[model samples]
Target: MALLNDIDGLQKPDNHYILVLYPGAETYESLKNALAPLISDLIILKKRGFNQIGGYYWSVELYFSSDWKFLAICLGMKSANTLHFCPWCDCSKNEMNTTSKKINKSMDNIKVNYHKINGHTKEPLFHMILLHNWMFDELHILLRITDRLWELMLSDLRRENVNEEIWKEKILLEMKQLKISFQFWYKRNSNNLLHTSLMGPDKLKILRELDLTAIFQSRT
Candidate 1:
């Protein structure tokens, strides 16, 4: 599914437009073909301003936004776990922790170099938009960060020899108190505990209201 939103406009349901809607695997070739018509229209829109019925002209400034995985796929970049993982900059896996780096990548540079440059596996599907104009989904970033924090919390509980069932129950109880639906269960084939996949709002509640000290109090 591809959605187009007017950023400058009010946050309303009508402001969002669905460009493409289909069910299929999201691959480079698939996305390139799926978005071909949209891209073609965007190129023309960017070059020539769209004229309105009442003597008004709207100049389009295109921006592409998606989750990191989809963004990587669209940009024809390697997965985040790869050596040259970042789509925005030349930063490799080792340098990801560094903050003070120059923004050296541009759409022109990426187009010229294509697969030969900074983590790019092929030409970007949305080459009409500038590289800087490509935005990351904020919800995904929050979800991923909270996921890591949840993992670390679980590791800490395990390290302290906390009973799995007890901790799981405690977590579920806490989630219930916070009005967030969460659970822990084991698959038939796997010993690992799998929990409910929380959405952005639920994850935010967990991050803000989850009482870690209470969860660890019995161990201490």
Candidate 2:
């Protein structure tokens, strides 16, 4: 839903804005209608000689939130949620033999099949990548887990075992500490002032190295 500006070999946010705001259920027809003009605009950019390479127009690179069903529709695929079907790589379980190992795929083969198999697609219109917003995903999960844990501690099964005042103090202190920790991590990990340009893949790489779960577990 946002255009990426290439800055120093990095795709960063420049003038970020919402493209659509609709009420009620969103369907494939609705999405295509909303997206058609943007796609046409990219084609116009090509016509204007804005982003040409090797006598061919470079397709626009689009990163979207991790909505598997929606992404499948965007990619002109029937589905993409199963382990058998990955847009990134080819790895699928054998259809004939249930116990057989997965079949690995070559990049060339995947691209050829992917472009050819879509019922509605004549050719790829853009380069799309799934974007799982780690900041929001982790924050939401962490807060929910914290809330549930607090509830369980105060439930009838364990309420009278510990002093309520002391328990509350401990829980509050831990929550405050986590908040401070997360702030520090955010400030350190972010390169842009607005924090809107954090690359999903780069963040995932950093997370693998840092292993924030271990840190959280240590605190608990």
Candidate 3:
């Protein structure tokens, strides 16, 4: 909390800024305990002579994870993968395995249904949204899919009656070409960091351009 005292001088009054706190699993309990008191002080400061409006620290914004299902559970969110997760909205994901069909048939609702409890428990806590990590969702998965595609290409090349040494050279060249393509796409319009920071709208736009129903022909 004391560290934030220095922050006031650096930014203008109306400018909005996020203060992200990343407390690991084990320290989460302690961090929560400490943050409560600090926020209370900030609220008090706002009420006093200080002009620091503390609304930003008062509420949670977003949560990130590789596994949406597990993150949903931790945040007391009903699976986004299910239709029943939204209470007010009347929409659902189509059961068809085809991604394109599902996108077309479904209305794509963003509302989240919070879990409620009565009996022994007092209150229910839930996150507003669960975001996928950039590394896991984009880079890692794309690399894996590309690797599988390259293996398939190599298998096709193997069936040729060319010499084994020449075939190996062809595989190396193919690998280099694939790597170059991935690099170009990764750094599409900007540097690595900016490219990886692609948000939901951009990702969805790219997906809409793909042949979502196309099945991979490679077994390797």
Best by lDDT: 1
Candidate 2 lDDT, 19-100, residue by residue in tens: 6566635555666677777767755653564455667655544344435555555555455434444443344533324444
**Each model's C-alpha lDDT?**
0.81, 0.43, 0.36
Ranking 1 against 2 by lDDT, winner = 1
Question: Per-candidate TM vs. native?
Answer: 0.87, 0.37, 0.30
Winner on lDDT between 1 and 3 is: 1
How many angstroms is residue 97 displaced in model 3 relative to the true structure, after the best TM-score fit?
Answer: 5.7
Q: How many backbone clashes does candidate 2 have?
A: 0
lDDT of 3 by residue, 161-191 (tens): 5554454444334335433221112356863
Backbone clash pairs for candidate 2 read: none
Off by over 4 Å in 1: 1-9, 161-166, 186-191
Instruction: Return the TM-score for candidate 1, rounded to 2 decimals.
Output: 0.87
Best-to-worst ranking by lDDT: 1, 2, 3
